[model samples]
Target chain A: MHFMTALKAAWRQRDSLLCVGLDPDPAKLPAHLAGQPEAIFEFCREIVDATADLACCFKPQIAYFAAQRAEDQLEALIEHIHRRHPEVPVILDAKRGDIGSTAEQYAIEAFERYGADAITVSPYMGRDSVEPYFAYPDKGVILLCRTSNAGGSDLQFLDVGGPAGQERLFERVARLVAEEWNTGGNCGLVVGATFPDEIARVRQLTGDLPLLVPGIGAQGGDIEATVKAGCSADGSGLMISSSRAILYASRGEDFAEAARRVATATRDAINVHRPT
Target chain B: MHFMTALKAAWRQRDSLLCVGLDPDPAKLPAHLAGQPEAIFEFCREIVDATADLACCFKPQIAYFAAQRAEDQLEALIEHIHRRHPEVPVILDAKRGDIGSTAEQYAIEAFERYGADAITVSPYMGRDSVEPYFAYPDKGVILLCRTSNAGGSDLQFLDVGGPAGQERLFERVARLVAEEWNTGGNCGLVVGATFPDEIARVRQLTGDLPLLVPGIGAQGGDIEATVKAGCSADGSGLMISSSRAILYASRGEDFAEAARRVATATRDAINVHRPT
Candidate 1:
C-alpha cells in the first residue's frame, strides 16, 4: 500500500495520532540495557513493541543510530518493527536534502535499506532535492514547514513575497508543497505542535494532507491546542510525535511498561480534543 | 587547527582551490573494482591518493556509502584520507540539519564518528540546528546558501524581506549567516559554482568567510566566472568542488591516473584566476 494510504489505515486501526519517536540516546538508556551489545537497537525494539499498539506510526531519527556506528542495528530495529507490528508505518526522520542522484541514494537508504514507510526531508535545497524522492511512488515525503524550535523563527518567519503577511517562508513552503510538490498525493508538511497557530495556518493552506506535528512531549507543546489547530476535516491526519517523555519514562527495569502507559495517556489526551 | 585556518593553509600549501567530491556510485564504478568487498572505499582511496596533492579538501557525499550499506567503508575512507594525506581537509557532504540533541547527534556522526574536518549543513532550521556543531571548537559548519541546481531558484530567489533586490531567501540567508551565525567564526557558506552572480553577492555579504562551491564539472558550471566571483579579497577562499567529471573520469584501470590529470588541470585553471 502507498504510505499515505497505509498511514490513514494505521490511524484508524490504532485509534491514535501519536508517532512514537525512536531516538535512542545511549546516555539515557535504562540500567539493564546500558553497555549491552546492540543496546541502541534493543532499547528501541522494546519501546516499539510496548507502544506499537498506541501509536499511528514510529519515527526513528537516523542521526541517533549513525552517530554510534549502529546503522546495522537501525536496520534490524526497523525490520523488527515491520515484523512485529505490520500495521504501523515507520517514518525515518533523517531530514535529508540534496540534489540529483545524491537524493536518490538517500531515498534508497530510507526505503530500500532501512525500509521506512515514509521519510522527512528538508526542502531548503528546493524542488530537485525533493523530486528524486518522489520517484518512490509508494513512500511519503514530509517537508519541514514550521519546526518546533525557537530558532525556527530565524528564517522560516521571513516575509517571502506573497499577499500581505500571508507568505512567510513557512507558509510559502506549505503552499508550494500543497500545489506543486504533492503531484503524487504522497507529500506532506511538518508543522510543529509548538506553533499551533502556524499549524492551523498550514492546515488552512494545505487541506487534509497529512501533517507530522512533532513537539508535545518534552518540547512542551499543548496537546489540546495542537489537536484543535491540526486534524483533517475527518478529525484525523496529524501524526503527533512524542519522544523523550515516552522513551525514558523510567530509567529502571519497567521502562517499556512505563512507555506504554505514557503513550496510552498521550494518545487518549489527543483524542479528547480530536472531536472524533 | 580551525577548519578555516586549515583550509587557508591547504589552499596556500597545495596552491589549489579544488575540492574533489567522492560520490562513488556502484553503477559508475570501474570494471576492475566493480563488486569488490570494499569497492567504495578502495575507489575513493585511489582517487584521494591520485588527487590529494592537487586539491585543498575532499568531500565524500554520505548517501553514496550509506545507500550501498558501505558506511563502514565511508568511515574507513575518511580515516585513510587523514592518515595518508594529512594536508587535505575532508568535508562530510551530508548537508544535515536538525535541532537540539538530534543536531548534536549529527554533529557527533560527522566530527566524532566519521571524523570529518568539516561538514555541510542546511540552514533552513536556523541557529539551533547549526549551533550544536559549533560546540566543537575545532570543526567547521558550512550552510547551504545559493545551491547549484536549477531547482534552487524555486524558493531561494523569492523576495524575502530586505532592501529591494538584497532580500531573496538565499540573500536573506547570506545576510543572517554573515551577521549572526558566525559568532565563533567557525562557520561558512555553500554557494554553488552554477550561479556566479549570487556567489559574488554572497561573497560581498560574507566578507572573507570561505565558500564551498559545488557544480563545476558534470553540473556545467563555468569555472572562470566561479573563480572570478567567489574568490575572497586575498583570492583563495573558495573550495570549488567537482564530482562526476573527476570521479568517473574513465571506466577503466587508468581511472585513477585520468582523475589526477583532471584534478591537475582543474586546479591549475582555478589558480590562473587567483590574485597571488
Candidate 2:
C-alpha cells in the first residue's frame, strides 16, 4: 500500500486529479452543521462520502481540527474515510518540520494515529527532518515548493550560489528532492497550480514524481494551465487540490451533493487537459 | 503580556536563560511511570514544577504530545503552567508553516487553544504564511534560521541571488524578520546552539530580538559559546533550550528533581558567559 501505488490506482479508477482538501473551518461550517457536536467530523464525513468516488485523495489540514480543539474528531474522520472509501488515500496536510525524534512523533501522528497515507512536511530543517517520515515505507512525503501565495517569492525565488550554479531556491529543492531526498521513491513536491511556469520547471527537475498542486478553485488557478504544465509523461502524477470552493459550494442541506457536483466538474475539467 | 516583556521579566527575576524543553517521549518514560494512563502529563507537570524557578521559559514540543494522543494533556499542561508558573512563558515548538486562513487556524491552535505565549514556525512559505501568526498582537513568532540539524545546511546556507547580495538563505531570513516582517516588534529567530558562529551571525542580523537556541545539553552545544554568541548587548535576548540531557537525566523516580539539577546547572553555566 505504498502511497504512489495507492494514488495511481485511485487516479485510474476515479479518472481524477482532484484531491479534496478537508479544511473544516468551524467558523465557516454550513448552517445545519455549524455549532453541532463533532461538526468538523460530521461535515468532513459528508464531503468524503459524496466525493469519494470522484477524488484521487482526501487532504485533511490538521490545523483546522486543532484550532477547533477537535483533534479527536480528526482521528474519527480519517477512520471513517478509510473504512468507507478504502480506494482513496489520505494526505495529512500538517506541514510539520522538526529534526530527528520529533519528526518521528509527527510521522506517527499522521500515519499511525490518523491513518493518513501521506503527509505534507516543511523542508526548512532539511533531510533528517524529512527522513523520519520515510520510515513508514508506504507513506509519502510532499515538500513545499513554489507555493501559490505571493509571499512565497520572498525566499523560494532566490537563486542559490555554489557549485550548484544559478538554480533558484525552489529549483534547487526540486533537484535535491528528486536526487538525494527521494531515498525510497516515495517523495513528492507541492508546486502550486497558480504558478504553472514554476510547476513545469519542477516537473522537469523531478521527472515522474507526483506534484500535489494546491490552488485553483478559490485561489483562481487555471486548471488547463496546471494540467498541461504539471502532468507526467503518462498524463498523471498530479493532484490538483481545491478546498474552499468545493467544500463550501452551497453551504445548504445539499452541501455534500453540491460538493460532489463541484468535484465531478473539477475532475472532468482536469481530464480534458490530460494528454491522450 | 507581550512575549519579550514577559521573557525579559522572567530572565531578570529568575536569573536564567534556560528554556526547559518538555519533550516527553512515551516510549522512554521512567520505570515507575511507563504504563501510567496520564504519565505524559504527570511527568511534564512534575518536571515543570521542579524547573519552573530555575528556568526562564518552558517549551513543549507539540509532536511529543500529539504522537501519544495527549494533545489534551498538552492543553492541560500549558494551562497548568500558566496558573502555577505564570512568570514563565510557554513556547509551542511546532515549526508550523502554511498560508492565509490556514495559518490563522494554526495561530489560534497555538495561542488560543493551547494557550502558548509563542510558537516556533518555519519561514519557508515567507510573509503571508508567517503574518497570520502575528495577528495575535501580544504573542511571539520565532522563525527557523540555521537549525541545529546537519541537513539544515542543505538549503539554509545557500547564497541568495538578486539584490540581496551574497547573503545566505538564513541571513536573508534574519534580515527579513528584523526589517520587514517584524510588523509589531514581536518576532524572533531560532538559531541552533550547535552552530555558535551562525548564532552570532543571526544575532548580528536580528538585533535585540530573542533567539531560541535549541541544541545545547544532549545535542552537544557548548553553553559558553552559545551564550556569548547569542546574547544581545543587554545580555538577555536568548532562550538556550535543552531537552534530552535534562528530561531523561536520571530516568528514575526522582527524574523530576534530576531535571531540575540539570536545568539549574545549565542556566548558571549560561550566565557565566553573559556579557553583563
Candidate 3:
C-alpha cells in the first residue's frame, strides 16, 4: 500500500492525529525492566499495547536503540507492532541522509531490515541524498524542514534566493519538495510543532502534503495552535507526535496506563482544533 | 589527543593524503569469504592491512555496515584499526544530525561505541544538532558542504543571501562553520573533489581548516586539480578519499594486493600537486 493510503487508513481507524514517539532510553526504562536483556523491546511492546488504538503511528527514534546496541530489539519492536497492531504505521525516526549508494543502504536498513513503514531523512545533501529513500513508494520519506531545536534558525532561516524568489531556507525547501520533488507522492515534511507560525506557512507552501509535527507535549508546543496551523482542510494530513511527554508520564509500573492516558489526551487535543 | 593532532600524526607517519573508504558490500566480497558471518570484517581487515601504509585515514561508511546489521563488526574493525594501525584515524562517515538528545545518542554511538576518531555530520538542523558531536573535543565533526552527487546543486547551490553578501548555500555553510561554529577547532568541511572550483572557493573561505575531499578515483574526480585547489598553503589540511576504485580494483583472489596498488597510486597522484 502507498504511504498516504496506509497513513489515512491508520488515521481513520484510530481516530487520531497522534504519533507517539517510542524512544526507550535505557536510563529512563522502568525499575522492573531495568536489568533485563530485552528491556528496550519489552518497554516498547507494553507502550504499543497500551496506546496502539489511540495512536495513528508509532515513531521509534533509531538513535536510542543504536546507542544501546539494540538494533535487533528495534527490529523486534517494529515486528511486534506490525503483528499485533497492523493498522498503526511505524515511522523510524532515523533522519539519515547520504550520497547515492550509501543512501540506498540506509533505505534498505530502514525499510527492509527494520520493517519501518516510514522513515525520516535529512535534506542537507540536496535531492540525490534524499531520493534513494523515495525508492520505496510504499513507505513515507519525512524530510527534516524546520526543526524544533533552538538552533534550528541557524541555517534553516537563512534567506536563500531561489526560483521562487527570496524566501527563508526552510520555505525554499518546502517549495522545492512540494513542487519539484513530490513526484513520487510519498514525500512528507517534518515541521516542528513548536513553531506554529512556521507550520502555517509551510502548510501554505506544501498544500496537501502531510506534515509530521513534532515538539508537542515534551517540547512544550501549543497543541491547539499546532493543530490549527498544521492540519489540512479536510482535518487530516497532520501527524502531531509527542515522545517524552507520553512515554515517561509516570516512570513507575503504571507507565503503560499513564502512556495510554497521555496518548488519548494528545489525540483528542489535536482533534479538538482540527478542521471539521 | 585532538582529531587534528591525530590526523596530522597519521598523515606524517603514513606520508599519504589518501583516505581509503572501507565500504564492504556483501555482494562484492571475495568468493572465499562469501557466506562467512565475518565476511564484512575480514574483507575490511584485508583491505585495511593492504592499504594501511599507503593511506592517511580509513573512513568506514556506517550505512554499509548498518545495512548488513554488522555494527558489531564495525566496532571490531575500528578496534582492529586502533590496535594495529594506531596512527590512522577512523572517520565513521555517518552524516548524522538530529535534535540535542538524539544527537547525543549518535555521538555515543560514533565516538564511544564505535571508537571512531571522527564522524561526519549534517548541518541541516543547525548548531544544536551538530553540537553534541563537538562535545568530544578530541574527535572530529566533518560537516557536509559541497557534495559530489548530481543533485548536490539542488539546494546546496542556492544563492543564499548571507552576512557576506549573496553567496551560494554551500558557501554560507562554509562561512558558518569556518567563522563561527569551529570554536572547538575540531571541525572539518566535506568538499567533493568533483567540484574543484567549489573546493578552491571553500579553501579560500575556510583557511587552515582541514578539508575531507571525496569523489576521487572511481567518482571521476581529478586528483591533481583537487589537490591543487583543496590543499592549504603548507600542503596539508586535506584528506582525499577514494572508495570503489581502491576496493574493487580487482575482484579476484589478488583483491588485497590490487587494492594496495591502487591506494599507492592514488596517494602518489594526490602528492604530485601538493605544495612542497
Identify the leading candidate in terms of lDDT.
Answer: 1
Estimate, for each residue in B24-74, the C-alpha lDDT of model 2 and write its tens digit.
Answer: 998778989988889999999999999999888999999999999998999
Candidate 3 deviant stretches above 4 angstroms: none
TM-score of chain A of 3: 0.98
Candidate 1 displacement at residue B251 in angstroms: 1.0
Candidate 1: regions farther than 4 A off: A163-166, B163-166
Docking class of 3: high
For candidate 3, write residues B11-99 as lDDT tens digits. Answer: 78777889999899887887888899998999999999999998889999999999999999999999999999998999999999999
lDDT per model, in order?
Answer: 0.92, 0.91, 0.90
What ranking emerges by DockQ with the best candidate at the front?
Answer: 2, 1, 3
Which residue pairs in candidate 1 have backbone atoms (N, alpha carbon, C) closer than 3 angstroms, thus clashing?
none
**lDDT computed for candidate 1:** 0.92
Question: Candidate 2: where is the Cα deviation over 4 Å?
Answer: A162-164, B162-164
Error (Å) of candidate 3 at residue B233 is: 1.4
Backbone clash pairs for candidate 2 read none
Q: Write the per-residue lDDT of candidate 1 for residues B1-276, one digit (tens) a residue.
A: 788888989999988999999999999999999879989899999999999999999999999999999989999999999999988899999999998889999999999999999999999998987899989988989999999998899888988768764378888888888898889887889998989999999999889989999989989899999999989988888999998999999999999999999999999898888777
Q: What is the DockQ (computed on Cα atoms) for candidate 1? A: 0.86
